[model samples]
Target chain A: MIMQTIDLEADGLRALNATLHAQKDDTNQTSWEVVNAKGSHAIAVGLDAPIEVTVRGSTGYYCGGMNKQATINVQGSAGPGVGENMMSGTIVVEGDASQYAGATGHGGLLVVKGNASSRCGISMKGIDIVVHGNIGHMSAFMAQSGNLVVCGDAGDALGDSLYEARIFVRGEVKSLGADCIEKEMRPEHLEILRDLLERAGADAKPEEFRRYGSARQLYNFDVDNAGAY
Target chain B: MCGIVGLFLKDKSLEPKLGEMLTEMLVTMTDRGPDSAGIAVYGADAAGQGKLTVQSDDAERDFASLAEDLGTAIDAKVSLYQKDTHAVLVAPADKLDQMRQALRELRGNVRVMSAGDTIEIYKEVGLPKDVAARFEISKMGGSHGIGHTRMATESAVTTMGAHPFSTGPDQCLVHNGSLSNHNSLRRKLRREGIRIETENDTEVGAAYLTWKMQHGSTLGQALESSLEDLDGFFTFVVGTKDGFGVVRDPIACKPAVMAETDQYVAFGTEYRALANLPGIETARVWEPEPATVYFWNH
Candidate 1:
C-alpha cells in the first residue's frame, strides 16, 4: 500500500518512469501519482506489476508500453500509444486522449473521458477501450479482436481494416472503415451502451444512441473484390 | 457487436440468386460487425400474404405459442417469421392500428415496420452474414427492404437486438446512431404493452414511429413527426412494399453515405463500403442531408 507521488516540472518525466519501471519487480502494489506532467514521453514503459501508475497531466507517446498486469491512470489528455502492446490490466484517462492511445494492445481496458486522435486503438488484439469523447480517423485499424466504445463523435474512416473486433459509438461518425456496412439496429445494443456509458460516467442516453458496427462483408476473401478495402 | 443481412426473395426467377448476393454482401462487411455470424433466407416457395416478418431472438419457439400468447392482446399473425432473436409477424397494412394493439401486448419496444410481402432482419454477437445464415435467409425480392449491423456496448450480444425490425404489416427499418431521448420515449411506447425485446436506442426509435403509425399516420407522416420529436445523432433507411425512406438526425455525428445509379440506390457508413454496390461510380456518390427525412416510392 505504498504511494509514490512525483511532480515533473518542465523537465522530462522519463527518469521518473524509469524509476517506476525499475520498481515493477517489487511485490508491493505501489501507487504512482504524477503531477505537472506536461507532454512527457515514455512515462511508464516496460513495467509489469500488480501496482498502479497515475499521470495527473498531459502525456506524450508510449505512456504505457509492454504492460503486464499493471494499471495506469492519466488524469488528462494523453499522446499516442498510451497503452501500446499492453498484455493485461487497465489504463484510465480522465480527459481527452491523443492518437494511438492503446495501439496494438492485446488485453485490458483503456477508458478516456474525451475524444481520441487517429489510430486510437489501432491493431488492438483483445483490449477493451471506452472513450467518452470523439475519436479520430483510422481507429482500430487492422484490429484483430477487442471492444471499442465511443460515447462521442468519430472522425472519418473509423475501424478501417478491422478484424474480429466489436465497436460501439454513441455519437456521429464521419465515415466507416473499408469493408464495413450498416446492419440492423436492435435492442441489445441499447442496453449494452447504457451500461457502458454508465460505467464511463458519460451523460449520453443508451436508448437515444443507435448502434453502428461491421456489416460482415469481408469475413473471407474473393478474387473479384481483391482490390477493395 | 455484429453485422446482419436478410433477404426474402419474392421473385424466384431472378438469376444469380438474391440470397447468394445478400450473403456475399454480408460476408464482405464482416469487419464492420465480427463478434459472431448468422443469416436468414425465405424463398418464394414460403411466401405468404398479410404477414409481418420479425428477425429477433427465440427463433426456436414455435409461432403458435407466441401468437397464442398474444392472441387476446393484438390482432396479427405472430407466427411465420422466427429466427433466433427476430420475429416477423404479418399484420394489417394499416400500420397504426396494428401498432396500437401491439403496444398493449408486449412489455418492451419491438423495432417495427410495415411495408410489403418480405421483412428482412439480422443481428447477433458476430457479423451480418452470420446472422443471415442462421435463419437461412438468402434473398429479398420485394419492392424494397431494410438491413442493419451492430456494435455492442451496454447490452449483451444476443439475437433479439438485431436489425431490420418489422413494425408488423409491411414496414421495416435499418438504423445508425443513438437517441438522446430514448428513455422518455420507451416509457410512452411500453405504456400500452408493446413489449420491447431488447434495450437498444433503436427499439425506442422504431417504437416512436410505430406509435405514430398506430395512431392513423402514414409512414411518411410518422417520419415527419419524428423529425421533431426524436433527439440524438442518427441516420435511418426505412423500406416498405413499394418504396423506402431515408432520414438523418438533427445533429448527424454518424456517417451515412447516399448513392444512386441508373439501376439502384444504396447507402452505407463509409463510401468505401459501397464502392462496388450497384451504381457505385464516384459521380453518383453523395452524403445524405443531415437532419432531414426523405422517402422514395415507385
Candidate 2:
C-alpha cells in the first residue's frame, strides 16, 4: 500500500497538486490546518486510475473536475462545481457544498453529508448524487440522466426540465419544475436509499425516509402535455 | 451599500449585452441598499470620463463659478456644471491621460475625478428606481459600468451619503456590513482635516481609504491598513473604472460569493440570486475567496 500525506500549505499543496499523475493506486490525505488557499481552480483533475484522495478541511472550486475512476473525500466543506463533468469516480463531501455540485457528471457517485446550494445536479448525464440535508432552489435542472436523492427538504422548482433522472425526497418540496411529478413510494427504493446512506455514512433511519422517481411521461415529447410540463 | 452591475462585451456595442440582465440583477438586489440608486451606462457614443466631480469650500463662492475656474485652469470646455459637480467629458476612449490630468489640474475643495472614463454619482435619499429615473442614464455608453444603492447610517443619507462612494479619484466603495471602529477612525480622519460625512460606519471606511488615495497610497494598501486598523464584520465590493475589487471580514460572518464563467463574472449576497446568468455552463462555476481581498481586470 503506497500512501501520501500533504499538509495543504501553499508550497506543499501546490507542489503536490502540480505533479499528480495516476500511475497506480495513490492515496493522499490532508489534516486540519489553517491554509488560506484562495481561488486555485481545478484542485484535482484528470485521473483515470483508481486512486483515493482526501482533503480534511474546506476546499476551493472544482475540487474533483474531469475525474475518471478516483475516490475523493473531504471531511469539511467544498466549493462550487465539485465533481463537475466527472466520467467515473466517487466524491464524498462530509459538509455542505456551494452551488452546482456534481454538475454534468457522466457517471459517478457524489454523496454530500450536508445541504447543497442551488442546482445541485444541473445537466447530469449518468450519476448517483445523494444528499442528507435540504437543497436550495432548482436542484436538478435540465438533467439528462441521473439520480438525485434528498433526505431533507428541497427548495422551489425541484427537478425542473428533468429527463430520465430519478429524484427521491423524504421531506417537503417547495415547488415542482416543468415535467416533474411526485410519484408513489415503494419498498425497493427504501432498500436502495439505505444502501446509499450506508456508503455515505449517514445516520438517519431508513423508515423515516420516503421515495420519489421519474414520472417517465416527460421522457418522450408530447403535444397535449406541453402546458403540464 | 448599493447595487452594482458589470458587463463585459466582446463587441463594441455594450447594449443588448447587459441592458436586460443588468436591470434584473440590480432590481433583485435593490432591497439590500435602498437610500439612492443610479446607473452609469457605457455603450455607443460613450465617453470614458462621464463627468467631473468637484469638491470645494470657498465660503460664498458659487459652484458654477468654481466649475468655470476649473475649466480655465484646465483650458477645456465645461459642458455641465452644477453645485460642486462638473463634467468635461470626451468620447471613444481617445483622451485617457489628458483627461486624467485635466481633472487633476483644478484644485479647490474642487477635485476632478476619473477623467478618462467613469461615472460620477451624486445621490440622495430615495428608492433606487426613483433616484435612477431622475437622471437620464443612457448617454454615457461603454462596455461596462457599476451602479449603487445606499442606506444612510452615521451621517444623514444626503446626496453625499449615496454610494459607489468615491473614496478617491479613481476608487469607489459599496459595503454590505458594518465597521467596528467608527468613532476612533473618524476622529483620526477629522483631526487630519478630512471632512467626515454621514454617520454610517461605511463612510468612515470610505473616508479612510479616500485620505489614503489622496495621499498617493494604493487601494490595496488602504485595504491592508483597514484589515488591522478598523475592526468589524464587513463585506464590500469595491472597484475603479477599469477593475473589480472584493473583500470580507476576518470572522466570515456575512456571506459573499462569486460565480464566474468565460462570458460573465457575478458576485451576489447569496447563490440563489445569481443562479441563472446569461450563459452559465455546468463546468465553469466557482466561488470566490471569503475573508480576503479579491480583484480582477473585468
Tens-place lDDT per residue, model 2, B105-171, is 5443444333334545534457766655444343344555556665554556655556666665446
TM-score of 1: 0.46
Per-residue alpha-carbon lDDT of candidate 1 for residues B1-298, written as tens digits (9 for 90 to 100): 2332323232334423555555665665566566544333222323444444443333454343656555445554444456555566554444435643563466234433233444444555665666566656564443333456666553555655556556544566666666778887888789966756668777777777788888899888888788899887667766665556788665454555545655445554543344434433333544455556776565
Every model: iRMSD: 14.7, 9.9
**On a 0 to 100 scale, what is the lDDT of residue B150 in model 1?**
69
Could you list the CA RMSD of all candidates, in the order they appear? 20.6, 18.8
Q: Which stretches of candidate 1 lie over 4 Å from their true place?
A: A1-229, B1-17, B36-48, B54-116, B120-124, B192-194
Q: What DockQ do you compute for every candidate structure? A: 0.02, 0.04
Show the lowest summed lDDT stretch of 10 residues, model 2 chain A: A30-39
Please, what is the TM-score per model? 0.46, 0.50
What is the TM-score (0 to 1) of candidate 2?
Answer: 0.50
Off by over 4 Å in 2: A1-229, B1-20, B38-50, B53-74, B81-117, B138-140, B153-155, B213-217, B272-276, B281-285
CA displacement after TM-score superposition, residue A129 of candidate 2 (Å): 14
